[model samples]
Target chain A: MQQSNAPWRTPALIIVAGCLIALLTFGVRAGFGLFLEPMSQDQGWGREVFAFAIALQNLLWGLGQPFAGALADRYGSGRVLALGGLFYGLGVWLMAHAATPWQLQLSAGVLVGLGLAGASFAIALAAMSRAVSEERRSWVLGIGTAAGSLGQFLMVPLGQAFLAAYGWSTALTLLGCGVLLVIPLAGVLKGRAVAGGATSATTREQTLGEALREASGHGGYWYLTSGFFVCGFHVAFIATHLPAYLVDNGIAASTAAWALALVGLFNVIGSYSAGVLGGRYSKKYLLSSLYLTRAVVIAVFVLAPLSTVSVYLFAAAMGLLWLSTVPLTSGLVAQIFGPRYMATLFGIVFLSHQLGAFLGVWLGGYLFDNTGSYALVWWISVALGITSAILHWPIDERRVPRLANAAP
Target chain B: MTGHRHAALLLLAVLAAWSLLLGLALWQLRLNDEQAGKVVVLFPPAWDAQTHFERTLRAGGLVVGQAPLANLWVVYSEQAGFVGRLKDQGAWIAFQPAPFAIVTLGGCFSGPGALPPSFLKTRRLSGDRP
Candidate 1:
């Protein structure tokens, strides 16, 4: 890796700060599901409206990620992260006061979406990847992913407690304040992707256009992107609708809240394990296996009788698979293409993920409103998981010729 | 040495911030328990407006208003044990709406064209309760 000579720019500092940023950003985003019920009930709107807004948020996050990543590549992640934090905080603050669907779309969907693109895990992971050696890179990425899960675990309960005490509006306002902490930590992660013509041990000087074209031409990249779409779909669907589904089935609201928290908590172990294992195994195979396992877990949860025990069991089982794809998929991008433009390239992949998220969340609400049940969405999730497993199995894990030739 | 010290300081600061947030959330939740009178009443999905009205009246509570959800309503009563009465009358779930009043969002009960006079009366009654 290209090491900075500055005393404070140690790899440890970058990794620590980057992990914290990922934690805050992902943690805050994960808690949005807790608001869907209250917001929908208050507005007298169908689930579709809030789902559409959140779906739009995912779409915009995906749409803006490349631009955000490119800017982070050209300038530095710190500025992008700080700007994103401001927009994110404002978006949440505005979402609290949104009286109409359009206002909700603008604040929660557009502003927060764009803000997430700039301050998301993709940016933080890219910076962290460049800070470490290749041997330790995947493990570091896992740690960052784990931190994000930890945030979800901590923040969801906190958000629930806040909602219980202060109400939804005050809860969101307080959460917005929590997101602003990202700005001050941004200072530690200041440096462009190519500092003095080197990044992540690569000295190749490729322009932005070349990087995009090269990646676009690779079949594996497309496969990887498509597979990631399923990941997004499964995540957003469950996060948004699972609590409602449980409530409809006669579970207490507090149990539903704890169920989501359990998903986050268990994911901490799952993500870290996936990261450590990715370093020693085939990333493609690991990803393939993870998707296949997701299908089975969902199938069992839906087929079995609904009880608090089943719900908690399902949460724990699914938690192990949740967000576990992140480290391995990101590792593949860094491995195959080189980490020089990882923020931009991985941002594209993440865009696919967010697009899937958009569809999953929106479709869940639309389907439920029409049929009065989420059964079809669960079946669709199962089918997509199997297909994703197939899509990933054929990906060639080899580096492109350029990266191969440049390797010492 | 300096890098190690800087990293340690950052860790400490982050931990402190998180601890403070957790403490605040817990404390507020505790305080909310003391001021819980107004409750959110949920009925079965098939329940209609008349059913919600009949049920609330049966439970000896005034209907504050309905939320966006067809089966969910904001019910207010100064009568103690009113929540238990709601459960006795087939309410799916009745819990304190303390800080989560659905009507306060303005979409449901804000403008003059919004809720009825009875809703306004009910709101006035429950205003100081929670």
Candidate 2:
């Protein structure tokens, strides 16, 4: 039965807990790149070696997201998150001292990927979604997404300073400590997620199998997934390679850090605005326009002369576009399938996103190694942005008939 | 109602603590101690020039370590007369005196080791532009 513990313990605690998890997990993940040059130099390996490991991590994260949600669905997100935190801490700790490339792959790549799956924004966002009122869902989702931006803004410099002060191994161990903070936050999210919102009291709970079947058959769902993949590609490629690109081009390392921080800082606004806007407008159109704008922005950035001014401008512009898609994409999934199976459906969609992330990060390194440049990747991002722009245009945003008929 | 209020309050307190931790972490990152009087001395760009350039540093005083950039040596204790001798010997030096800047960038990558403060800055590397 769907029951609320009370108002105090209800949505408020859930939101705070969810947001904190988003901040910690996302924040810790964002700062890993600061260790790249230092780590590779010490290990006597190429940049692609480190890049490939992180790319594998993203691939594993994508592969694990759906299963993590499934586990959360079956056994409750609390236990799953606890398990995730454990793995995350262990993976980071192991990564800190990994002496061999294979070990680095296992710890940073495989284990961290699995850990992220369990502790990702999906679990927290899904928990909050189930707890909040339907009318307030998009607003709450935006807040959660913004917290992720906050994490990136705050953690990057700290990670850099830590890398500078304590060395990369000790600095990474500190990040491991930071991620462990999520484990306790998971406990507060205890209790089963009720399929709240528009579903009536008499509506029967949909089986996981039924939801999967419905989503696979829906053309719009496929479109949404494919569009989301582009988001992952753009975000991952930049996160992994942008700093190195700037540094390689004779720009100060601080500017690269500032650029990333600016992205995180502005994404707070972008994500929140998208959330607020989704409630009043067509999410599909908004998504389409956002993608189109990304294509234009990337084209302009690449064509323009590269300078410190250009870099900061690009960061701020991209920041506004970055992660804004999260609330909308997840909200669309919720709207289409109803909030009942949101974590699972969205997780599957997120899988596609991670797949794109894997390609983006991997190809950034692979191509850079072969060609001695990131030029090809930049144009590829522009091309993917256009494809996603068109793909998101045709998504049918109307609620599925089952949910519509069942609602009051 | 009381239980709900207590839960909300508790959660708010947790949030406050988390914010404090993040603020503290950022504060910690800003607390870098300047590596006083450190400098990256650039040897002439030619590949064959590196060995002789290293020899000049050894003859000048003491080469602290081999830098990442080719023909760059991290030298310690800038001797006033000795710097002139190195300059006369055909070496360009970037004097990083005090209160050096640290920049932090984000990438979702892995960690390996620590780099010296001198290599972290680009403008100090080679005088390409302003």
Candidate 3:
């Protein structure tokens, strides 16, 4: 049964706000790749400089997530989200004015990264998960992920138009202002997790340290963490590099832009389906299958001839698997450990994902600069995908003893 | 269940709105294609007026107009492959001017309501004649 500790903080309201937050935060970040070409060209810097800043941004975002989740788990999501929005908006706004590499790193890398940690859809998922009953949690997580993908679908073109019309500086400033919209939405997402609701509550309140210790000892948690790393690597690499790769292969810039957007478009369907299916099936198995599918998809895309049609096809196929892992992976966390410290535990799992992202983005730039192709990195992604698929196969999906004992 | 239904309704509404916006953008692009020989050129933000002017001339284009934003210019050229030339000369993006300018300027000013007067001025300046 769903318990309402705060009648005002209805599940509907939380879901809505969480969805919007996911839209703004993920949408803005997804379009960062659009900046890479123009911004690097304008600054007379190599792709590595811009890539390093973005990689650092991912690293910082991943690093800050657990702490931000801890804070959200402890105090409330509202304050964390508000502060994050401010940082995010300010970071992007400053990034527009950053002339030097160091300045870019400070603004785009540090501030925006931290902003994402707090304001990202993960926090929203956690909040939304706590709002609904156990049966609905997976589906809600899917809704949030799908909304974020929709943001990507919507924002990429808008970002491209902004870049095409106003230039990168004004476009970035506009996006910065857009991120500030998160602050108001955060208000409705206020309140920590309900003390004893559905599968989330323990008979006795567990300390954060104990929660951390318990999660660390769980082998399934480590497997989930390791598997998520591949998701981060694949997504970050493709989102950051695919536009350039497509353009390099004789596709028009406009087509390339739309191809990236198409990924986001298809992702909405994939994420929602994953969410809906995750509720009905074993999340671990779903995760395993999603990874295996990614490996095969990437292998096929790479082996196929590059054309406008192939690019769009690859994007649509890849987008389906893109963030679909998010809901299932996070769902498994909520399922096994419960949603009590989901924000924190998921944050740690997300950290591995970010580490993969950092490597993916940085390595893509470095390899391209040295080898003049993204071919090597593409194969690495495929290998990692296969490895992650294998890792998730043996995970135990049952609820932890503590939560199982507390369950009615 | 009611909450879930409401959330689903909202999600559907969002997807619908996004699809609508995409349709509008594609329609605008098609409309923009009907008018040719004019391209919006985006230069680096750090570039000055002299650089933009010289670059446009170098790319075989005549400077037709400028947007409020510093680095975006409206250029006209009778020469073939004008957009390609602009790309060669380091223009970040070269595209049909109206769709991008109108959408961006409209966005900057909030909406179509605040758009007309500024847009009219831009149109006059952007014209091959004026």
Candidate 4:
């Protein structure tokens, strides 16, 4: 097989394209919370209603990621992203017009979630990895993750401004329009699938059963799955409930928005730093340290004085720690198993994250409705964070001995 | 081999670009920080509130100060409409009615049957016990 002209150019272009796609997908999704109160109030619905929908969206997103990744690995990422963009656009539009809770759930939860699975980092990273050298994969993965973080930062402020200017409904419609921007970028990923004689000779070489069997049989995969669950729990819990918690605590809405924004802003640093550090250190240890730090941070935050300064301090500190795990965790999977089936393996691990996400997002609202406070949820997060730290600590990061000895 | 090297250089270029953009954003935030002002308002306790008031104050470019001798602390805003939770109090209330009025309710703060509708707007601040 002959290499393409400008080999590095194509890979770098692919990563950039992946970044753009990630930016659009996550950017819009992060601002879903800003719509919660307004949408609930307008429909005379409960916070649980909105929370449930978002939770479903998160679960579905998680469920879809690996499958999307698998499809991209077999078929092509460009098509997956293109289709995802369409579904994202349609889902956001449907959400804007949704009058019933079920309708909201269907639009925001199922459609948007599935859409994200296709266009998200799972697919993007896989595509980028195929284009780059093995040695640069971790750093490239970091760049891609940071791109999503950048999207969160840029889009949160943009979403806020849109909400302030156009109301939630119109804002969502505009965001849907922005999601369509991915359609064009998808073109870049076309015809870039890595070709292998072995892959083509055996149509069953990369079957879903094969991928599942490979991951399930591996001890490292379980650790990745368990550790990822904690990430989902922490992110979903914070994203879904932080604003309301701030409002409930007598903090102003603007400050809450900034808190959320700061989370994204600081994560830019955290994610990049994690990427760089992961390149230098053991990725698993870095992940363990991040989770432990998150546990410690949450404990200090809840126990400390409730002031604007303290909250901002907490946001900045946590933000720096947030999402840093993504590059490391994803990089480790690619390192241990290789990128051939990375999307599928990573997707399954992400499923655990989403399950945690499902519980975190749903339980936060449920407990709030039941007990009228976020205390239970915060305690749960602390426990989960500590547990995640423990889980990652024992993960064997060495390559699978079986795969290492197999014919190349 | 040469192609791989060029690819490596290109990847580095993209990384540099992304880092620069992030750095610019952080710099902009720092500049904005220097211009921010402090606003003070009284928050009543009784309402079981979270960080809403403080979040809103920060969003409005005001620094939330510590509680004064009275039960109320200074919010960065001079506006009367903002609501917040009182420190160590159980209920939430607005900041503008009167600072001295809130201080008078000190011991009875957040006690059942004592809070009026005004207090309902403000919840108790987290970690604050009355």
Candidate 5:
């Protein structure tokens, strides 16, 4: 019996690297909401002021992702992470000392958003996916996602503690420093092949514009993009406003923070489980189920008794459904189009997600100011979730036209 | 034939296991019928100028009556006016109807004419003086 060389080792290493990258990127982003109230109170700014900044951060993050992903795909993930770390550090420092709303917008919103785009799992997972075998791709993606969820869990509580002791500005500065830790991990991502083997069949490489046109022409891409938009809206709205909502409802701020943390912790399990399941089941059905579950969970939570227990329950339920979409969504993109320009294509899809995020975060603040209730925002989330569930139902998850023709 | 049948049986077993797991998780989740308790509710005192501003309080499956006259107090901050008054010192509607249940909602209220019948209830009760 011939001993097979440990072929699995490379994939395992790539998964670990992906997980660490995810942890640093999302941990900081998840903790951003914790600063909303404290920073606003200190600066005498309205919730909308900070909300707008975070909304911009989300938008720019979406905008920056494809470019970052392309750069990493072309050059390697090392340089991207290094550059992102610098920007992230600078952004956090500026946020710490920000006196004006515009400064907050620039530092926290634009800079951090772009920094995260460069550093996040979108790029990291693409790199990992390319490095691993097709059989392990979904599992690797899941591990990467679960790492980000773990970051959310760790960072939210840490942010809460920082707010308690050192204040928001100082806490932000320290958190920024923590993001810089990713710089070292980026070294491990060096020297991998940029394009997956499947992507190289076409003689003529499509330019970004041509790629966009090709993707746009495909009905599945639009469905993916539109459904992803709801995911963004639901996540960004809740992340930005739920703490404030809890505070308004007379719940203790710490309890609200814990609610957010619990979401992250449970999502760790949910995302990993979803990834495992995606391997065996139809990815589309799994995605549809996730969205529908989100709608049902949100509707039931809002209608149920509001208490610490309910808050945690809601958080856990929602968390499990949260970002469980990422692995499946990105997995489908790869499944449909191959991983040649996976980063760039996924970035465009993510742009739609960010657009929804922009609306969700901004609209939450706007509506709150106008109506003094989050009822409308909650209902919109439910509607969007249901819509997303339906949108993903009919997507033909087959290889792209060009790829199909070229294959032997 | 044997290999194909074995593969099919394996697939069925996996599916069955997943179904059982999902069903068990769903069954464990308790569905509560009670609606979320409002910790605080804000309304203009003018809305209750005539009638007694009644509010019910509930905690731990126990329902208790609260006399609006005794429990509900009209708070007037100097910072507010006819419109600003409610804006400044709006009524506190307790969602949890308990001491520890945190306040959840705060806002101002405005309407036409004098204070409502509920607001006048306190005055009427005070008016029956000898």
Candidate 6:
């Protein structure tokens, strides 16, 4: 890992700032579902209209990740993050005034999605990795990732209370104000990645073209990318639809909020634990096990009773497994290719995740509207979990030969 | 070294504060879950929830006041379980029942259409002197 000696760019400051960015960005994205029923009811729109808009948001976010990532890799993440924060706040504020689906598509879908691409874990983790030692790398990554869950734990309940007290419009505007904090912190994240040519103890200088071409040709990269799709599918479906699913199953609306909060709370532990384990274990195997465990957890939850106790238990179980995949997946990229091109490489992988998210959220609403059940998408999530489990098992974890030369 | 330590301390302090707020929020939600049964209910002008849900209300609560033209009734339930029982039997549920269930997001609320003039008599927190 490489970093300048600026006081503000120290590992401690980077970790603190990076974690906050991840917390705010990922946290807000996770609770958009709590607004679904209220917003739909207020506008007299069916679930499909809101679901499709969120689906577009997911798709656009995924679409934006690669470009945002490339730019961050070329320049620094500070400006990208600031710009992303501005757009994010703008998007949230616009969502408050949107009367039609088209307005929602522009604000909630396009702008928020694009903004998320800039400030998300993909960039923050990549940048933070450059500030720490290789030995502390995976653990640091986990810390940064866990902050997202912490944010969710903090934000979802607040969102519920706001939506319940004020209308969705006012709640959205307040949340928008919350996002504006990210702009200044982006400056705190000002640090450059050490290119491959820079003399670092264990890093090599690889040009953008070289890194992209190398990654494009690697079979393991494809496997890693493809496997991440299930993660997106599972997370988006649960986040966007779980509140309504709880309401449908005779649980209170607050239970939905509490359930999501439970997922967020437990996820902090899960992500950090996964990080610690990733540092000691093979990332590929850890990923495979995580995916398999998710399939089993979801299957068990489906078979169990839907009472509040059972729902809390399921949220705890799923939360432990939820975004736990993030560290392992990103760590695998750094492990195999080296951290030099991690932002760009991981961004591509995240794109696949977002594509899966699009299908999961849109299809969740579509299927529910047509069939009056989310059972089909639930099954799809289970099947894809198994598929990703199998996909990760064979990914080669060895560093690329060209970049394998000793860092010094 | 002290500067780094101070930075770390500040981060920890911020995190602790956020955790406190978050814990309090969750604690508040769980605590308020029981207290939200306090509400103003208005049935159809000619109808009554107390008389209609008489057996359930008698077992669980007391009707504090009534306004016939407003089609409104203030039912103060000392029992927190009162609302849950009403919800269990699929009784009408509303966020603000006096102004005619303006925002019923959960449970059964008949339908979502314009409330009749008889049910639209709005009230303050101190409603129906009867």
Candidate 6's C-alpha runs over 4 A off are A36-49, A99-101, A163-170, A196-205, A240-258, A303-310, A363-379, B1-16, B19-130
DockQ of the candidate models in sequence: 0.07, 0.12, 0.05, 0.05, 0.02, 0.05
Model 1 off-target regions past 4 Å? A3-5, A33-52, A96-104, A163-171, A195-203, A246-256, A305-307, A366-375, B1-16, B28-130
Off by over 4 Å in 5: A1-9, A36-52, A97-105, A162-170, A191-199, A203-207, A243-256, A304-310, A368-372, A406-408, B1-130
TM-score of chain B of 4: 0.24
TM-score for candidate 4 = 0.71
- Residue pairs in collision within model 3: none
In Å, residue A292's CA in model 2 sits off its true spot by 0.7
Tens-digit lDDT string for candidate 1 (A288-307): 99999999889988888878
Task: For candidate 1, list the clashing residue pairs, or say none.
Answer: A44-B68, A167-B99
Model 3, span A1-408: residue lDDT tens: 232346787788888889989988877876676677678789998877876777677778888999999998888888788889999999999999989999998998899989999999878888889888788889999989888877766676676666665678988998899899899988888777656644445634688899999999999999999999888788777765665666566565556555655676788888988998999999998999999999998888878777788888888898788888989999999999888688899999998988787677679879877777778888898899899999999999998898888777
User: TM-score of chain A for each candidate?
Assistant: 0.89, 0.90, 0.90, 0.87, 0.86, 0.88
lDDT (tens digit, per residue) of candidate 4 on A1-408: 111224434765677788778767876776676677678889999877987887677667877888888887767778888888888888998999999999998998889888888888777877776666666777777777877877666565455446554677987898898898888888776643544433333322446677578778878789888988888778767755666677667776556656766777788778767877887799988998899999998888888867799779988888888778888998898777666667777877777877876677678879877877888889888998889888888888876654454426
The lowest-lDDT stretch of 10 consecutive residues in candidate 5 chain A is A1-10
For model 5, residues A1-408, the per-residue Cα lDDT tens digits are 001123543544555666777876776676675576667788899877987887677667878988987776556666787788778778888999999999999998888888878887887777666666666667667777776776665555455445544567777887788777777766666543433244454713755567667888989899999999898888778866676676566665657656765676677778877777777788888999899999999898788767899888998898888888988999888777776567778877888887887678679879877776888889889999999999999998888787777665
Q: Which ten residues in a row have the lowest lDDT in candidate 4 chain B?
A: B104-113
Clashing pairs in 6: A196-A204, A196-A205, A197-A205, A202-A407
Calculate the i-RMS of every candidate, to one decimal place: 13.6, 6.9, 14.7, 14.3, 17.8, 14.6
Global local distance difference test of model 2: 0.72
TM-score of chain B of each: 0.48, 0.40, 0.54, 0.24, 0.24, 0.34
The most accurate candidate by DockQ is: 2
What lDDT tens digits, residue by residue, belong to model 2 across residues A144-215?
A: 787776666666556655665567899899889878878898887765555554575523467778888988
Quote the B-chain TM-score, candidate 5: 0.24
